[model samples]
Target: MKKTLFCAATAAMAIVSSPAMAQEAGDIQLKVVGTFVSPDGGIEEVVVDGVGLPAGTDTAANDNFVPTIAVEYFVSKNFSIETIAGTTQHDVDAVSGLPAGTEVVSNALLLPATFTAKAHFDLGGVKPYVGAGGAYFIWLRDSAGGGIVPLGATDADLSNELGFVLQAGVDIPVNDSGFGVTLDAKRYFIDTTLQVRAGDTLVLETDHKLDPWVLSAGVSYRF
Candidate 1:
């Protein structure tokens, strides 16, 4: 699975760099963005219900900070396809006394490639835009060893997921090369889950849902 994700990512980059694709670059716009994001996790816990072990329970309110960068190619001045990539680290703290004093930290790489339909409103020095599109998420990782242990003691698995990206931003013209500063914010609506295997102990199983947010700011060069 890891190999396949890398290969797919490489192929996508290749296509973007190809001559034919380059020629289709049309309204090429490049931006470097800083994202302020929030991540929420839905976790399950294993408990002994006075007879045997009870099923996992669901919990939320897990939060974290993350950042990202985005590059977009305008199909027109108002329509575009953008690829936003970033990294996120989440720490799940200990709760109750069940698996108390345990922490699970998950570090993941995110690639959300989306197709957007936007309308740009040029307000002199500020070019603001609004858009919406579908996004694909790739390359995710989860790590343990904080204070909590996964049920089966397995690692984190984040398969590719399909979601939607909604965005709004403004561009400030800088120089003669159409170079400028840009501020953009976007939200990714994704339903993601983490799973752990039960090696020899039927005492624990790991599974949870994660839905995250993405925000950013950067420089832009329009040709």
Candidate 2:
């Protein structure tokens, strides 16, 4: 009876350890992502001279793109944590409605850091995952315009903002220690104030609602 009991216990242990071994072999992955932004909203009006008169100059929001680098660590076969660091650029108006047809462009760089909890599923050689997380965005730039102004106005008022992120993508295996590609998207629900006050008087004061969309595709590595 003792010999029979020992054999049964060993069989049960083998059955339990099989899945753990498979999970340990597929627990870590690293990915790189590139995101593109489409500027489909908002309009800006500009003045040609200091006459406080509208020169009928108008410009469209046409500049926004970001690059993201992330590392994903799998806690188990189906769950992981991912952190990302990247930079984004925002472009402003050129000259519109000018008699000589003057054009102006401005840009700003932003550092967006995010953390996410992800759930991964493997189907044969294909793995798909979905994630949700919080993001903190920092806008950095004083004056990033591409025009000449004698007044020398080069100061911007932007602050750090908070938002939520959601992503879903597929992973295709390459080799033993393989690489995969993913396409992901995110949106930020944010509103901030941008002001340009040269002196005690206000030149520009308005609230900007900056809700941006990111579409990206990148390669990933699994360990």
Candidate 3:
């Protein structure tokens, strides 16, 4: 997935770099990108009731690739406000206590709503930016995996949590027009709580660390 995104970014850069206008205040840029979401998920603590859980239980979240869109408004020639829209899905597996790898949560979908304020720097023709932002990870859906369902676990839910993010990226102009290619990466400092239930009984409740690295590459049009 990383190789594919790198190749796409290379292609975009090669196709777009010609002559381009400079950014200015009151500019609006729209970007469409292919994003890679990689979450470093793990169990922080387990609250067990009416079930048996191993002492050293831990977890890992599967990576996902999805399409993303962003809108940025230049507040100044060197500063902008940006936000993105996208959804990513992941599956969690118990990495230590259950087995070598045992599925615990299947099809957990999330909407990561974010906003960032960035400082852009001009290096000859290429523009590089550093941003600081806030994020809210909203869990849209989730279900118990096969490994947990057999243990009478019926449903699972991840808590909606608010966190912060750090970002860095570069934008390369494609032409004298408002066309460009962009490559971006953001690191999210966040966490979530997972609760599993069976009928009317709360079977398992665990806290998880959800710091995810979100990488993106694609084209941008500014006007």
Candidate 4:
């Protein structure tokens, strides 16, 4: 009778530890998503100018929708590292400074290079994750907006900056074959400096707050 009990316990342990029970250690997940980027273009403080900035000076960046792709590598069943590929474009407008609703930046294209480490929790078939990571915002191209051009602005340049992000998301598997749907959100703490020049003379310089909320929903395939 004791021998029978030992055999049963061994079999139970094997079943619990089998690869079929959960995601393996080296799983890779690819997610194709559509992302929404919204940024708060509030001027933190004017960095450089001949005269002082107007009181209550502020700005707002328009929202953008772009396509993004993410690749994730599982370090273990519960831990993973992820990187993303995408770019977004925005038009910054003056809200309180200058004329209200005036465009300060025509089209500023941005590339956010990101890498994150995530921890996941499996609740039934739903996997929820939280991640933290580093990001560098690269300004690909930009031009003077309508309002700035009339104000003697001949060229516009935004500085590249580094920042970090906090992330949260959920993955719901459609079936057991590594196909799923994912919903994710990330909040970035970052800022950039805008420099306006007219004939080599710095006409306006301002520090802008670009704290953007990135939201995404998409399909996931793990292998």
Q: Name the best candidate (by TM-score).
A: 3
Instruction: Name the candidate that leads on lDDT.
Output: 3
| Alpha-carbon RMSD of each model | 10.7, 13.4, 1.9, 11.0
Deviation (Å) of 99 in candidate 4: 1.5
Ranking by TM-score: 3, 4, 2, 1
Q: What TM-score do all the candidates reach, one by one?
A: 0.67, 0.68, 0.93, 0.88
Q: Give the alpha carbon lDDT tens digit for every residue of 1-223 in model 4.
A: 2354345334433333212236878999999988889999989888777434567878899999899999999999999999999999999998885679888898999999999999999876567899999999999999999987877888889999999999998776766677777788899999999999887999889999998999887778899
Question: How do the residues 84-140 of candidate 3 rate in per-residue lDDT, one tens digit apiece?
Answer: 999999999989978857888999999999999999998745788999999999998
Flag regions of model 4 displaced more than 4 Å.
1-21, 51-53
- Winner on lDDT between 2 and 4 is 4
TM-score of 2: 0.68
Pairs with steric clashes in candidate 2: 94-104, 95-104
lDDT of model 2, residue 144: 26
State the lDDT at 153 in candidate 4: 85
Off by over 4 Å in 3: 1-17
lDDT of 1 by residue, 1-223 (tens): 2354345334433333212212133677777655566655556433222213224434343544455566677776556766666665555544444354355444555555666666677554556788888877665556544333534444545457788778876666655456666666667777554443335333334344445565555566777
Relative to the true structure, candidate 3 has a C-alpha RMSD (angstroms) of 1.9
Give the least accurate 10-residue stretch of model 1, judged by summed lDDT.
Answer: 16-25
What shift in Å separates residue 70 of candidate 1 from its native position after superposition?
Answer: 2.2
Worst 10 residues of 2 by lDDT: 12-21
